[model samples]
Target: MSPSLFTSLDVKSGGGTAVFSFLILLLLKMAFDTFGYKMGMNPWPGVFGWYCNPAYRLFDFLLGYTGFLVLEKTDLKVSSWKISVIQCVTLVFYFAACHLFDKQWVPAPFILLTLVLIFAFTLPGGIFNAIFGNRVLTHLGNISFELYIVHQVNINLMNHTLLKWTGNNHLLVFFMLLVISWLMAEFFSLNPIKRFVTKSIYKSKIFI
Candidate 1:
């Protein structure tokens, strides 16, 4: 569940470990999916209905710690562009490998490229901070935790209700889910509820 206790090590080492874990999880998921498809089986376990599978749990744990390690190690003088670059390269390689091996990898490259573009956009701000001694992307980075948490719940709830009522229209459902989730995240992040919950949990050190 929680990362190993040793995850509190130096940020760079922790980050490297987290990234390694993520890559391992991603590869494992691909292997599982491949084997499942070949055998005509569902890839995810039944409990949690697709959310709390071993692959997802492993990746989520690594990603959460990666963010923590990045925040811990961040310095105004040092650019975080290197981490972004490494993330992008790893994502690209993972997708490329999937595409090479799987006939169903059509969406993998597109998804990975979108993530790479997002990281690339942040790279400039990181470079500016390193050169001009300003924390340009600090605020954007800070809200990311709240955004991640809120977005997933919003998306899942919206998708489930819409599908139940309207039946399956995949593209329409996806766009609606995306728009609703982003709006919900933005709204919730600006409200006092966000601050109250975050402070009550993280500040109180009750759920660390």
Candidate 2:
């Protein structure tokens, strides 16, 4: 995913290439999910099972690339209200699909999420600015990579150590984990630590 690679792929150019790529990746994901289910090899069943699949990871990366591609390539002049409405509607559909459907091999949720992300990346001025343009979100974005790495460990630690203290209140445990994770991410966001962590992550297979 370097600039040269993207240029070579010509993903930014208008054509059926991107669409075809997405379709092929989607089919691969479905195949992997079905195979994993049949073999009982997926430790995390349902939608979560797709996370560990190589095909799904490629789809995920392409989905994200599509977001940035849309942001850079599109010149839509729609109203902020319309964009916000689209964002909200897409999110509603995504959540509904996640809860109502068995996602063993379904791609509805991911498709909806892609719509949400595409709109989100192209957020215009006005209400969108007032909301997503805020400093809190900017700060969170800055430390997002750090959060991604530490948040899970923080959740596991809190579940083991703090859940009993909170009388097994999962909600409270979640907030505690969130606070600790954010603090850890913020601490690691310091320039020196951030650089080292980023270098290590890029060198390892853990980074997408």
Each model's lDDT comes to: 0.52, 0.62
Off by over 4 Å in 1: 1-92, 100-142
lDDT against true structure, model 1: 0.52
Best by lDDT: 2
RMSD (CA, Å), each prediction:
7.8, 5.0
Which pairs of residues collide in model 1?
A: none
- Write the residue-wise lDDT of candidate 2 on 140-192 in tens digits: 97787567656755564457679789888889888988999899989999998
lDDT of 1 by residue, 1-208 (tens): 3233334434446447645654564465556545554454665544432333434443444544443444444443435767555555755776677667666553223334444444444444444346333463454455555455555555555677777766777778888876675666566678587677557754565445
Q: Give lDDT: candidate 1, residue 39.
A: 51
Output candidate 1 Cα RMSD: 7.8
